[model samples]
Target: MFRATETFATHAVANQPEPADPPDPWADDPALRGRLAAQGGDAQTPAALGAAIRDGDAWALGEAARRHPPELRLWDRAGRRLDEVAFHPAWHALMAMGLEAGYAARPWDGRPGGHVAHAAMVYLLTQAEPGVCCPMTMTYAAVPALRADPALAALWVPRLTAAAYDPALAPVAEKRAATMGMAMTEKQGGSDVRANTTRAERDGEDWRLTGHKWFCSAPMSDGFLTLAQAPGGLTCFVVPRWLPDGTRNAIRLQRLKDKCGNRANASAEIEYERAWAQRLGEEGQGVRTILGMVHHTRLDTAMAPAGLMRAALREALWWCEGRRAFGRRLIDQPLMRRVLADLCLDWEGALALGLRVAAAFDRGEQAFARIGVALAKFLANKRCMTVMAEAMEALGGMGYVEDTPMPMLYREAPLNGIWEGSGNVIVLDVLRTLSRVPEAREALEAEWDAGAGDPPYDAALAAFRDRWPGPPDEGDARLWAAQAAALLTASVLARTAPAPVAEGYARARLADCPPVPGALTGLAEGAILARLGGAGPAGESE
Candidate 1:
């Protein structure tokens, strides 16, 4: 909720508008001139730099930024209407800089990474210019290996990165994103990797992938990172945008997905025809590599919603304080203040959860990787939708109106949860991860003997067993419901375990904390048992 004092007029104080100064010719500001000289921009004219897009190097991208500038673009469609067109054009300019800067090289490429390359990608994403950023990030993620095979990466990086400005490419293809990356998705096999129906067969030295993928984000990208079933195991491959001789491959664009958000970037259904592909990683390692990418993407998805919420709330708060209703400021109303507070609290939770997951990933923690990723995506995305809704309500009709940005963000935020992996899929993955932990099972049993460890979790485990006296049927919805419920209960329990009593006043303070609930404990126990029995709720068992 927002109080009048806390509203934009007060907060707007933090957003002071500065007087525009005449463009500096080159006096000597270290921050500006220093960075420029360091980057070899000291003696160059902005025009001279704009002309350098032909090389698509970092310096050229900087020059492009000086020339083109940046802004956000929101959209409405032919049959279905989108909420708003939102993006910062500067992000696009930065991506062009990335391409020009040659930052699209392989992961292992010797190019220096600092503020420039990273700023380029961050600007695109934060500003909703993922057309260029998504493709570049995907390509960059695989660059270590791509660089190892320079012929392949070298041939495509330039084409993909250069899409932002190429005249012919932008008309039919994604001039902003280029043709370097393709999305991998399936109707039947989103999280259930084993359910993939796409097949790849060997043809002499070449392999062909055949399947239909839904929501290929950048269909115009020169190649798609595809998943297919191999004789030996599940495999991942990169199918080129065109044939060996540079002809269009046998890929049919079924239809562009009229998505709820992120419309600036292409999301289309695609059909493959014996599409030639080169294997990435080993046959059985497809799931591993794909999951690795999914982890990062999940973080990206989480961050997008959080950022959107921040921007939306800021807009709403500004409006509340600045606008008037009933001859008084909206923020003066206690209810509005509460709403604003709730919005901030939601934002904090989502931000904390997303940052925690991202930090874990940054540290390369593989043990709880899946669980952390799912949790972050699950919580952050859900919070984004919640906050957006709250913002919209707080704004009343204005929130829904297109002129204001809140509705656009509210409409677009839900897509994040559904796209990366539906909420259900992510919850299931968390359950699966927890179920597989031997220590988790051991802890459940040990809690009973200790009579003091995470009792709610232990009780939840017991209750689950009481409900299901025998092993579960794979198809039983109760089994999955129980599993997810148990995971949540257990997660809370693990997080809230009572600290050991200290010797004095500290010990007494610890003792005052409530004991863990029994129902949650029983739930954990039953889920562990079911998991240890080489099974899970229906549709997930081996």
Candidate 2:
């Protein structure tokens, strides 16, 4: 006692930022609140869910889940086939919270603004944990695709929509609730579903699927909406994990993919050895049927990036506010302020654009929703990488350290862009949509026209039309898509965001501002930064 305590002095921690406790994601996020209200979504559910995530141990749970990735248990110790994936308790806890809060059920709950509310949930849940989003999104998206078969929809929609989480290894009928996954891509054909070779044979009332799925995400779901070649070309089917007799299905888990990210959720390569399946839609209509699911999932993919950007920026801002350098708070430094403020434009534009597309979904504007979501997904996801990188840099060394959430956010940033559709796929789809669906182009133009007063936006719109005239050559497709998406984002911001914020985006993005973050000249720094903490004219805390 005389020697050790006195001789060894431990330095006290100084000028370190305390952990940013989870704010009410619903209440603190004025952009989310404002957009939800503007889009006519019911704020009651989102508010409640946000509070639950904030007040509960969601952050800790998220961290624990990320730390402990899911493990594949293909067989039991007794040498029997199990085909189960084991997740940490934290994963199940987060999944339970999401399902209980209607993450998968809201849109089909017969409520107004169902889609909008569902989109909001996607944004909110993504902030807490991005990995768990894969299964829930598939579950949410499956409802519409399943509706292609009224019988299948009737049997499965209730379980899919039930506000409960049942992780039992049992038949769907035996569980109180169920989650859904999708297995569409084969090794030979990733985005080209028409090139699928998985064969489905008639086995009485049900079909038997026999092929390999290269990527099967959330492998433990109760059922999966899969695509296979049937007697009449490719078709969609519902493949259950367990047979009605409480026996395992013929689906074989080859192995889990060693993915670079989304560690908490399991993605697998599997073989469908005559797995029992029910035909979901008419044979040969697989692409058309599955497009329904793909479309909805794209909406989530679009919104998730917005949530990730928000989460990263919040961390950076907190660090700047509490940490000091050169005898001044980091937030008080002019250069730091410029960087953070410029970053805000991206996060704000992304949130606004994504929600606007969501609102289109809510209003049943299929023409606009189709094109709008693609634009939002493409633009927001691209901006997400930039925002995440800049925000990480703002935190200096701590951002790169695993001790903080930045690395996780950085890892997740590229996933949404790759999922649903990669960048090239999205751009080609936009061209296809605009070419085949004239109404989509008209709707898009109408949307842009609504924000015509901004000079920069107006000039950008004019230049886009003149440059394209009739869908620029495929070589220029990406450039066209990027310009169109940026203009669309600026248009949406003009109508929905505060004047200064909208003007800043138009000047920085639509005009001649450099592509890099913080390379801006005339951004209203005060107005944009004020929105970060939910305290500006347009972003008043609810």
Candidate 3:
């Protein structure tokens, strides 16, 4: 006992930061509150959900789910074919909570600001756990795609929009609720979905599909909206997990993808050996039909990066406020203040622009929504990697460790950028929208005009027009997208953000700010940092 006591005494912990407590995501974030209100969304649902997440130990659940990834159970003990994925209990719990809170069902509830509210929920749920969001997002987005077939929509839409969660393996009609998935990409085509090789043949009133899917997201869903080639060219179809006769479909799971991130969710490689399916849209309209789902999913992809940035920054700020270097807190250092203040601009701009796009969706501004979402997704995701890296660096060695959340956030940063569309795809889409749709250009100009009074923004807009009187060369599409997106973000911030925040963004991002982080000349650091509201260690101001 004496020897053990003497050995342990020398290894006492000292000056280590306490674990970051789970704060109310809705209550603690003034930016979220302001943006939600400005977008005409009520806070009651978000507030309640945020509190429930915090109180229900969602932080621990998220950690557990990621630490213990889902497992693919290909066969049962009896050796029968079973293409089922088994998830950790934590994953199931989070899914249940999200579905109950209307993560997938809110926008279809016939309430005002339904889409705006759905966007807010996306932002909030992403902070707690980004992995479990895949199924919920697909389920939410599938409502629109399903509408292409009124009969199918009538059968599936209610189950998809029901405020309940059912993970049973029965027919969708037999379950209390249902979730939807998507299987679009194949080996030959990533974004060039028009080149898909899947074959669909008419079988009586329904159809049968026979092809392989390279990436099938959320493979355990009750049904999937998939694409295949028909006699009339590519077409969209609804492939169920179970046939209407109550037996498993002929869909075979090849293997789950070993991804760099999003471990808690399952992405699969699968083959459809004459799998029964229902046509979702008319033949040869697959691209146009599935785009309805793609459009809405892009909104979540835009908002998720903001949520990730917010989560990482909160952790970094908490660590800095609690730990000290050279007899003063790390947050009190000049360099640290500049770094954090610089990071805050991206978060604020992203939040503002995303919610603004959601408001457009609510108001049925299709032209603006089409172009605005691409800009928001491209810019926000690009900034997310930088913010996540810097925030992790702020914590030094501890941030790299799994004990903290930085590693997960860093892994997840690039996912949204790659999902729905990569950077190049998004840039091309932006150019296409401007070139083909006159209303898209007008909508963009109208948005820029809303915040035209700012001197820096005005100069930038003039330069942008002069630089590209017509669309730039295809090689310069990325440059065009980046500058245009930044300008659009500045415009939105000028109208929605606080005075100092907006002014700083316009001066730094729009004018002469360098490409590097923490390279700043003049910014209201105190006011900028104040937006990340919380008390420091020992009740000190952050």
Candidate 4:
């Protein structure tokens, strides 16, 4: 005797879909290898490393990132001042992985395409765990600033490039690896480092710095690059945590910031009372010396949004592919396909744009790079926030909670836009270059013209170039930035991507190509899907 609803059976626990160990995302991504090849880098290392991240310890590391955000330990047990930050063992593991993969110092590899290779590697690694990239990126960017004082660079470079992870706070000689941090911002000047109030003075041929830095990132590092006012003018200084005599410096940690995201790395407020420092560059030349490092950081910051979007897109697509609703897979629906395709366009375009800027660095074409980095940073970071939102929506209720990676991705979305420089600052940088720098427009126009294969592209390029070569004002900076980004992205896509991708980009983005979602309209059942599609659904396994 059984009812229609129940036939002598009891309920069982429902097993939701979850993401498994992914295969080598790098080997399958021809685009990354292709980009690397253009720069003369060997893709074997990156491909192999990509497989390791996917098939190896990414999940465990990600759990550590989630379970144990960094903890700041300010004092030792015996009432001595330690001023240290303690991270989960997982953070160190992630850092070791990043360093071992050569993402940290590959730009200085003395190869033909080191910067490009480094950029591609960084772009991929950030997808797995973005929090640890902070310390590593700062360390990577610090090389140029150190190069200003070659003697100082000679002292620090070898220690920094070591792949081993040595977390114990001790003398550099005792550590297997070293990292660097920065402290330019104060409560007063955010992006305006020129307004810094920290003072540096000559102390028996050794410099002593005295002031407060409002945001000191990765405070556990062996050294820091800071800015202060000296007798001559604004000067850059290198402040080590330990003196040459192995004594602690006068630096004191105030408190760590409660940031909205990036929880795994410590951002501290520090006070310096005659803290020991060595001059980095000529007096009154702080900006000129530090600008190189800042430029490199901006390039990396621009890539973060793209990496984050890719992470989100993968998670969303995975959920859609496996879950069923309305009698079929959610991905089979027309609206969902349009959304995924739109997401794909943005993600791929962003990746292409980021790699293009990185290539500019490899080529050392400073003029082209100046304008290109600005446009890419402003445009890509802004779109990254929106793309993450759309991705979360595609995942529906699962995306709204802590059970999936979508929420984490969403929280970190706005960071790239705000870091290094905000949207307004970046746009102003672009305009300043166009208005003041000679040959700036010329270089940009050349990049724009490279995309013109038909009347529509030409017309768009004309529209873009027409807005330039005139008086610059902040009122129209966003419009100018958008057009510049679109033109540059289209130029790159037309040059590198396949015909269908170019066609899809043109039809969806440029409004030039004929509407043909008819065949391109499939719910991701092709090579493009394989490239941008996801693994299994995302959730923690029991």
Ranking by TM-score: 3, 2, 4, 1
lDDT of 2 at 330: 98
Question: In what order do the candidates fall by lDDT, top score first?
Answer: 3, 2, 4, 1
TM-score of each: 0.60, 0.92, 0.93, 0.89
Residue 265, candidate 1: alpha-carbon lDDT: 51
TM-score of 1: 0.60
Error at 382, model 2, angstroms? 0.7
lDDT of 3 at 440: 90
> Which sections of candidate 3 miss by over 4 Å?
1-8, 512-542
Candidate 4: residue 430 lDDT (0-100): 85
Query: Which regions of candidate 4 are displaced past 4 Å?
Result: 1-18, 38-40, 511-542
* Per-candidate alpha-carbon RMSD to the true structure: 12.7, 9.8, 10.1, 10.7
The lDDT for every candidate, in the order shown, is 0.51, 0.88, 0.89, 0.79
lDDT of 3 by residue, 132-248 (tens): 999999999999999999999998999999988999999988988999999999999989999999999999999999999999999999999999999999999999999877999
Candidate 2 residue-wise lDDT, 1-542, digit = tens:
13222233677567888655568888889888887777788887778789888877687889999888899888889999988899999999999888899989888888888888888888998998999989999999998899999888888999999988999889998888999999999989899888889999999988999999999999999999999998888899999999999999999999999887788889999999989999988898988998999999999999999999999999999999999999999999999998998888988888888888888887889999999999899888888999999999999988999998899999999999999999888888988998899999899889888889988889988987886777766656666777787888888888888888999999888875225333344566667877687465564443
Model 1 residue runs over 4 Å out of place are 1-124, 127-137, 140-182, 437-542
* Candidate 4 per-residue C-alpha lDDT over 1-542 given as tens digits, one digit per residue, 9 for 90 to 100: 23233233677433244445564557656766665665456575577568768766675686677679877787888989888888888888788777877776677777666677777777777777777888888888888889998888888887777655667667776677789888899999988989999999899977999999999988988999999999999999999998877889999999999998887778999999999999999999998888877888888888888878888998888888888787878899999988988877877778788888888888888998888888888778877887899999998888999878888889889988888888888888887888788787788778888888855567777765565667456666676677678778878888878766765776666653222122122243444444566442345121
lDDT against true structure, model 2: 0.88
